[model samples]
Target: MGLLFILLLGVAIHWASAAKLGVVQTEGGQVKGKNVKVSLLFRSVDVFKGVPFADVPGMWEKPKPHPGWDGVMRADTYRDRCLQVTLLQKKTRGSEDCLYLNIFVPQGRKLSTNLPVMVYLYGGAFLLGASNDMSFLGVSLYDGKEMADRGGVIVVTVNYRVGPLGFLSSGDARLPGNYALWDQHAAISWVRRNIAGFGGNPDNITLFGQSAGAASVSFQMLSPHSKGLFRRAISQGGVALSPWALQKNPMALTKKIAMKVGCWRMNEDVMIKCLKMSDPVKLTMAGKIDVLLILGKGTVMDLIEFSPVIDGDFIPDEPSKLFHNAAEFDFMAGVNSMDGHIFAGVDVPSINSKTANTTVKSVRGLLAGLTKEKGGAAVESAFSVYSSNWGSHPDPAVIKKTVADIETDFLFLVPTQIALQLHANNASGARTFSYLFSMKTRIPGFPSWVQAEHAEELQYLFGKPFSMPLIYFPRHRDLSKYMIAYWTNFARTGDPSIGESSVPAVWPAFTENRRVYLDINHKISKTSVSSDLRSYYVSYWTETYSLLPSTRQTGVLRAGDLSPPRGRPESSARET
Candidate 1:
């Protein structure tokens, strides 16, 4: 009788444990999700179909509470990515109702303890991306079992509206612009309210992003609305201070896009109606949208025009000015060693000319707010420096590489560094950390010239190294493990140091004098990288180009008293 009783108790315990770790019923339907999953070689966790943070809204903007689900929800498979119209392709399905968030929790024994939360914002130049991309799976970063065995943290990835629908802003009071940013805000609010149910500490949320996502993160730091949304921030490759961050006049641009789709002269109400009436496929096709234009130029327009803007509300001032004021926040910002190489291929001179010219124009425009003389000189100096750096390389490929590297520094890296410096100088208690990802992948069929190319880190960090193009390579597991450890550690402690790893030396912080950085290669190491390049960039920005007025710098030609309120174009050249 005693043996039988013991056996019955053991069976009951096993069933209860399985139920707790598996699927749970909701108002919707049956759902199952891993309590904690291994992603990117780290013991992190993920929970899907948990709960919606906000009430659902109907097509006409009628608010409705989310109808709870029935049975357990299986969160094993990723929800479908948000709808996007790929610039290179068409006929893709994207839905307007695609707002979702995924969570990754670190493995740990005490399941009920609160854990640090890292919220990731993805980047596709603010035009294309979703939280479900294989590169961002994050299972390896927070495998539940492993996190339980060791200590744990929580990871959250969110999807925001992208492209014209999300960013288009009209200066007109009728339009509520920056919907994409609003989506992000909503996601954060959701995290604050409900993350504790999944063992996440709402007070310890860290916001991080790459590329356009990074730019968005920067904007959040500057925005009063996002003042307390996150305690720390990590921006990779994209900084909001850059000329390419937000559109100068988004409302005007949105009108242009609207006209292209036969919605010209329409009021906000009519415009939305027309947009909804048109087929999504047809609407995407009417615009001669190139990937570069969609990604690069889109970010520069006005908040109401077509991009994130200096709205008196959501975004109060330019990111540069905001950073200069030394806005308080913990930050980690850096750029890839070959950030521009992704755009520069075998064509050397042609590509170099295009890139250099565009950069010169942008630099000139940015500095116009200060003084014309200074802005022109700054542009000239920047071009001269870039040319000299590339002139040393005899090989076209090498020359292209050099030019790309210089451009990356001028456009992305320096701006990020400057923001960090400004923040640090203000004595904001927020520490600034920097890193350079230079690890070259040995993946076959992948371009050998494209070492550590844009978006390469996504695969290893997501623990999906064997997925798609990355699977063609050898040593995927090795690389994935290293990436997982670094990212997870950063998510946990706001520092990426891994003491137990075979990897070399601790990554240095970007302090006042000694600007230490981590060079992530085949093996990670600490080094004083890109100092010379950064110095040149700073000189150009401060001395040569600090004279132009903000409106002029952004190419907003203001005519004299009667000149149509704003100035006409000075030249017929393509802006942006």
Candidate 2:
């Protein structure tokens, strides 16, 4: 009995020693994480959740780096998300002090591994999102554990301010918005400074995102302030050139939202001070005006009202004009098969409720607003083009598809094409690669006719959340595997297919004449589609308007630039 007791005590001591091995020493303090089994046969991966990279003091202020802590901080669970409105106009669980980031590292790996890092920024139309496990609409998204485990690379998902709290602008430094973008910059800076402690190569960080997050990535690539923070970037389904990506006459919108909150319009400074003292919830809810304009009836023009703006310091010029500077970094941009389906889905209400003339007029108003009167003739020309293609259909269903197709080309495909052309023509280093995800998503609740709606590619790259169905398993698992390989390979080396793995196809660089893109379905195929329709639209819009200049540097153009009361001669050029 005495011998057996001694043996049991020895085993207990050994087990306790093994448990302490998961502790990682960060600059802030020592944090202990747990090993999570992400795959059946593979070993567990270590995840440290809710690690504070910045200290956010309430709303409307910039984030500060977290001061070092005194002792061990147990990073075992997620912290509250940053304050933002949720789906269905409900306020979700989050706080102003929510500037945390989650990190996933390979378990039992030595410090010498020095894995490449991929940091993700979630997309929510610049409104709703968090760093923890949550699905946007039906697309289950935002987990780095699977990426870290499967790809053998470190993954970090960050949280920043969203909604009006992140992007409200007084058009000056006094109450300059884009605090959300600064929060992301702070995260990147923190990673650059401290990522080496977690077995990640700080020099090789890659920034990638979808939707508004993708737009943010584009801004980062263009901003001189964000230079050297990331080595490469991947922007999916969004670009800075999209009219919806930038707000016009932002101060007017700011004053309007302030009025809704009972703060009478005064000078910009006084109004900003009044807003700082108002109820934070009321301030956040007041932003629903931008929402109504964006997602309500009429055109899909306002669907992205609260997005990133040119704040002089961060974004100097329109991204299209700034491509010469952006050509320095390696870039990859892509789109889905049915990128227009989202706009089409939104158009159902407008078509059902409004008359055809009203719909056409609403679209024309959107075109004039988006193109600043220069594209008026082009808009008239486009209506004819669509009518001829769609058989001049007066039917609402035909009209809806036509409108969706036009918007798809206008909002996503054409802008991407222009960006790729600029980058390919001017980039100093790596050649740009583009892709088209054409696979029909098996995720439940997605319409069968919808081929890869906006962000379905997220599931293929990062495994779906457990709450969602296992739609991509067994059959499409290889696609996910190759995608992980492709992404991580790009992070390690500038080229995706240059690594040791046997990638199925050789992805060619995009060029003006070729316009080649990889079509990812059951099998990956390299092909180029006829671009006659797209080329015509692109030529008209580019010829009509110059790239929009920064509002801070140029002041609000809409307030002064609109056709002057029908009496004065119009300026030769207008800012759009």
lDDT of 2 by residue, 306-368 (tens): 877777877776666676767767888877766766765564445333344326665554444
| Candidate 1 lDDT tens digits, 443-534 | 44533444566666665555554333344345565566565565556656656674223344576566665555666655544442323224
Q: Which stretches of model 2 miss by more than 4 angstroms?
A: 1-21, 40-42, 108-112, 133-140, 289-297, 350-376, 391-400, 443-449, 465-470, 511-514, 526-537, 543-576
TM-score of each: 0.74, 0.83
By TM-score, who's the top model here? 2
How accurate locally, in lDDT, is each candidate?
0.56, 0.67
Assess candidate 1 and give its TM-score to the true structure: 0.74
